[model samples]
Structures are given as C-alpha cells and as structure tokens.
Target: MPDRIFLIHGYVEDPTIFDKLVPLLPPADYVPVNLADEFLRWQPINSVDARQVAQYLTNQYKITAEDTVIGHSMGGWIGIHIKQLTGAAVVQISTWTDQEKIKFPTHNLSVLRFFLKTGLTQSRFLTSFFLKQYPFDESTELYAHLLDNANKMSRLYIWQQLQTLFAKVSPLTVQPDLRIHARADNIVAPPDETFVEVPGDHFSLVFHAELVAEPIRTIIGNRPITDIW
Candidate 1:
C-alpha cells in the first residue's frame, strides 16, 4: 500500500500550513487533519485540550502503525500523544519534549497571559507593532496574513494553550522517529542531538519548506512501500 502521511496543523492554524510541503513530498494519501476550527471560531480556551484533539484525530483517522504523522509546534505535541495511542511514526518540528526546553520571550508567563486576557493582544496596532519589532516570519506577504489572522484569533484559546503547555513536566511521552527544529527558533530552548536544526524560526516549515521537506521526502522514500508508483 502507499505510505500514509498525515499532516497535523498547530493552534489557530488550518491545514494550509503544509501547502508548500505537500507537493514536495512523495505521492501518497496526504491527510491534513483540521484541529483548529474551534480555535478559529473563537471557542473558550478551557474547552480546547491537546489530548482531546489528539484523541479525536486518532479515532477520526484510524491511524495505523504504518502511517507517518508530521506535526508543527503545538500540533507536534498533539501528534506525540496520538502516536502513543496509534503506534504511528511521528515527526516533530519545532516542538519540545521537556517543558523547560520551551523558551518563551519572557519567563513570566503571567505577564503575557495577562495581556492575552485583554483585547490588546488582538488589536491591529499591537499585532502589527509586534511583527515589526520582533520579526520571526520570513515572507513579506506572510506579514499581511498574520496581521489579518490576529483579527480572527482568540486570545482566550492561546492563553489556555500556554497555561497547559507549560504545566506539564514532560509532554513528549512517545519518542518520535525523527525530530527537526530551527536553529534561530526563539520560542523553544536550544535543541540537542535529537533534532536536525534548520535555519529559520518557529515557523521554518512555512517560509523554508525546501529546507524542511528534503529530509521528510527522504524518510518517506527510503521506507519500504508495497505500492507501485
């Protein structure tokens, strides 16, 4: 059978995050799981749980041992939990197993969380100013998309994710088959031997799909597949 590749997106992001990587990968049944509908719809933060999302995806997709799950950021965390249930191979990009490994801009999440509670975080001025001051994105066009996304973003959901994300001692229970991180990633603490450090920030998969896609393609290509292309 053809290799199954499942693409899981992160918080508040749709399946379109993997658009650039899709065509670069080997032909297969590419399933981009949608886990952000609720977040995008402005649901309560308390309602969103990574484990719950993982469980839903596991049941919804009936992911098997032969399947490969590639996830970005928070999606990687969800994928790890799914792997624990489905025995599927997981690839984590820009995700940290250890809570201490996540390096937030300010160690005091309370300050950030407090700001997230207000409408200020979603304000056009604040969002645009942030993009200009702390530029993590690579594309000029993406800058505009991000500003647009901020308007639709739910600060409550992000606060919830941050609270739960750091509360865990070790979120990565299941070991992934491959780990890739960005060298200039300001969000996560420096990666060790477990990850192949690419040149980009937290969203390397978006701006630098070529850099990230090669290894993913190679892994899929080298794997034994019964399907004849």
Candidate 2:
C-alpha cells in the first residue's frame, strides 16, 4: 500500500464533496476526514484553533511525515497546521494564504455566533423564505443542505468552528506544496497570481473534477492507490 492521503472537507461540507474528485486521484489510500465529526469531538484549551485541531487529529490518526493532506477551502487552511505537526506534504485547493484578506458579510462575530449556536443557521423555514426573497445563484444552491442538516449538524460545531476560524489568531506559517484554485470561483475568489489556475469556480471540484485532478495527479507522483475508505 502507498502512503495515506487524507481528504479534508471545508466548513459545513461533508466528505461527499470529494465524491467526484476521489476517482481521478493518483494511487494512494485516499481517506476523507470529516472535519465536523472529528473537530467537534475535540475539546480545546483556550478556544479551538487550527493548530489545536490539527494536533488532535495528529494524535488520533497517528499522522506521520509520509502522509499527504489534501484540503478544500477552509479545510486547506487547517491542513497547513497538519503539515506543521507531521511534516506531511499539503495540497491546498480554493484556499487563501495569511496575507489574503477576506471580507465576511457580518463583522459582528457575536451576532454570527448567536445564530450558529442557537441552530438558527439551519432553519429551513427562514432559509426557504430567504432564498425566495434573495434568489442567490448557484453558490446558494451549494449551501442548500443547510436547510436539511439541522439535526445532523450541531450548533456547537458551527459556533466553535466559527470562533476558531474568525479568531484573530494567525494561522500557522506553513505553506502548502501545491495551491490549486479555480479562476472563476464566486464564493472564494481566487487571487490573480500564485495559484495554478484551473477552470470553473468553488464548485468546480464537483462539476470539473477532471480539471482539478490534473495538477493533483502530478503532485501525487507514482504512488499506487491500493484502497480507499
């Protein structure tokens, strides 16, 4: 068997987001880590942050230098810390570096925490009415499951993650070996330079896995994928 390749999904997304991309990957034991399931279970000192979460994962999974971590969006941000712990190579997709500034809709984290902690973010009735009222495009479609996942997705999970992500704490200084991003992503717009430009947007991993997989294949090299779970 070749080295393990852990696939980390982004916020509010399950391992299913990788369904399309997994088949095209190079030979390795492709393992998808449910950031929600694992990260939510970890109790942290101070507040939850990427490094702490990564350490939890390192201890639980016995991550080592031979492994590779492939993370999408926010998952990619967390993957850097995994690299810090295990010396594992990292592949970041649709993610940003520390220098990149993001403009969140709500600057008030307290109010944002209120909704996520109260399960208001998973409200189907409110979501349905809002979709009807605003009619956001495909990106909104991407988050449609939020309406159905109220019971499955915990308020604590979302709230705690937001706290970790939004905390002024700087993400670890580790840089990924490869940074692949879609040029047309609406949700997390790709920077003009640096990234190996690919076709489509944030959802391209679903619609254009072939294109996304091209770069990944080269990085994965000659590893023979014996099995995946």
Candidate 3:
C-alpha cells in the first residue's frame, strides 16, 4: 500500500509532460491525469475539472487521504482543489498563488483569448509561433514531442482553460506540503511566500528532471509501502 502519487499537468498539456520526472521518483503506483482531454474540454472552471479528476482516481485507483498529488502550473491550482476533496498531500511546482501573478504581461493572454474565440487558434503556424517564445529546450526530444501534442490541442479547449486561469481563484486555505519553484521563471513570479528554489527557468526545471525529482524524493522519504497500509 505505497502512497499513490498522482501527477497533474498544466494547460494544453497531457500526462506525457511528466514522462521525464515520473521515472525519477521513488517506486510507487504513479497516476498521471490528463486535463486536456475531451472529457475535460467543456470544464468551465478548475474546480469542476479537479472534481472529475478526483472521481476518476476514486473509481479507478481508490485514491484516498493517503495519496500524494503533485501539480505543475495550472495543475497546481487543481491540486488545491483535490486537497479540498480528498485531503491528499499536495506539492505545487511553479504555480502562482496570486491570480495577478499568473497573468504574465508578455504573453498577452487576452489577445490569445480573443484569437481563440474568433477561431484563429486553429492556425498551426500561430500556435507554433506563440509556443516558440516560451523558454523550453528546443533541442530536447521530449519538448519536441510536447510541442507536437500542444499543437493538436483544440482551440475551444484551450479557451476554456484560459478562462479558468483568468477567473478569480480562491485563496489557498491549506498550505501545500511542499512547494518547488524555478529561480528564473518568467511566467510566474518568484515565490515570496517560502518555497524551494531550483536552478533554471520554468520549462528548464522540468527539462532537468533529476534536479526537480531529487528534492521531491527526499520529501517522500524511504518508508516502505506496506507501512502506510
């Protein structure tokens, strides 16, 4: 009965985004939830999406209070909702606590929203061009594959997610068990509210999986699975 480790990915992303980091963690039942799927396509808010994720986990894996959830970016917000639902231990990575901080000025999210509403988000070139500005390692095979996946995301789905991001999020009532943030992340402001600082930008932190996973492993500790039962 090892603690179930659930990985929740961010906007326009799927579970595969965690491919690099998942393998680096201690052995346990690992579950990766994909929020950018048809089932979650119509979700109006993160809380609704998180409830569906919680239901999926409960039905499929019997997820309980003992489970541990790790979330990245938008996923981190969902992790907070999951904590409300299941009382699971939460770990947030490169996530913003303040709604204002999540809105990066350079990204021009409002313009992107307009494009999405006007059905301009279908342009492959536009999507590629927009994503190119992000500080991901283009040389890595993982990022290349992730880019391909991102290109395929539906415009409406992306718009729905963006709406959730822009909506007023409730303040975190429970402190996350652990918080990991990148020192040079441009998308989200650096954590002034206590967090573990790792080298690299937002994407690079995930790119360098070992650097991110080591600290998580240390927090997870060496307790045997059966002991939790």
RMSD of each: 3.5, 3.5, 4.0
Sorting all predicted structures by TM-score, with the top scorer first, yields 2, 1, 3
Q: Model 3 over residues 87-188: C-alpha lDDT tens digits?
A: 787788888656666745434567867777776665667656656776645334554565576557776566656655665444557767788888777667
TM-score per candidate, in order?
Answer: 0.79, 0.82, 0.77
Question: Residues 33-78, candidate 1, lDDT per residue (tens digit)?
Answer: 7655534444443544456666667777777778889998777877
Point out the higher-scoring one by lDDT: 2 or 3.
Answer: 2
Question: How many clashes in candidate 2?
Answer: 2
What's the C-alpha lDDT at position 207 in model 2?
A: 73
In candidate 3, stretches whose alpha carbon ends up further than 4 angstroms from where it belongs are 38-62, 106-113, 122-125, 128-132, 135-148, 222-229
Going through the candidates in order, what is the number of backbone clashes in each? 0, 2, 0
Candidate 2 local lDDT, 1-229, one digit each (tens): 3578999887678789889998888555778898777854665546676677778888888888788888887788778888987888898888765524343556356888777667666676666865565434645676566445544666777766676456555546567888888766655667554778877666677777898898888877743334432
Clashing pairs in 2: 27-225, 28-225
Model 1, runs deviating above 4 Å: 1-3, 38-48, 105-114, 154-171, 225-228
Span of 10 residues, lowest total lDDT, candidate 3: 41-50
Q: Against the true structure, whose TM-score is highest?
A: 2
